[model samples]
Target: MTDSDTGHSPVWARSKRRRSSGGGGGAFFGFLVFLLALFGAVVIGMSIKERSVAGGGAAIDGWIATGKASVMQAIGKAPAAADVAVEKAGDAAAATGDAVQAEAAQTADALKKQ
Candidate 1:
């Protein structure tokens, strides 16, 4: 009897048949996402390891202090200019105080004389 009459297809005939389509692209994208997650975990773990080796919290503190110092230097006034400003403010305040006191004394004397 022939292979088709025996109810079994021949291997060559099966090989010649077209295969059904599958969700191959979805599976490939899922694998890529898994690899990316694995890579991210490894990178985070290595960063933690490096931070631990490089003084951990102290390193972070030092970085913060350095950043603060850099900002202060960038925004801070020069010492000489700051001193001059302070002196000018103090002199202006003193002069204002003296003028107010003199005005008050003159007002009091005028009231007493009247």
Candidate 2:
């Protein structure tokens, strides 16, 4: 049989056109909505992950670090200085008391010898 009579189609033949007119606009809008939803979902997921990373445990760590630094600073400044001052005062008082006791004992011994 001849090529035209065999009803065989060419590989490059154009396909049939669809009859719908407004389907393109609807498809475009649906795709746009899908993209917006996907973007929103991604943003929400990232925020949730970020929050978890910074939530109770992480917040507690930060507070603990701040407290530790504050304690270190307090230790570095006034309280330790006060402690040193108090120790020096105590040493001076004890030394003064010992000197007074020694003088009193010497005076008593001299009186007894006289």
TM-score of 1: 0.34
lDDT of 1 at 41: 77
Tens-digit lDDT track of model 2 for 14-112:
232232556589789989999999866755665576676346455556768999999989878998789899999999999999999999999999999
What is the C-alpha lDDT profile of model 1 across 37-98, one tens digit per residue? 98667556655966663455555567789999998986676777889999999999999999
Q: Give the runs in model 2 whose Cα sits over 4 Å from its true position.
A: 1-76
TM-score of each candidate structure, all chains considered together: 0.34, 0.35
- Flag clash pairs in model 1: none
Give the lDDT of residue 28 in candidate 1: 86
Q: For model 1, give the 10-residue run with minimal summed lDDT.
A: 14-23
Please tell me which predicted candidate would have the highest lDDT against the true structure. 1
Q: Scored by CA lDDT, what does every candidate get?
A: 0.78, 0.77
> In terms of TM-score, how similar is model 2 to the real structure?
0.35
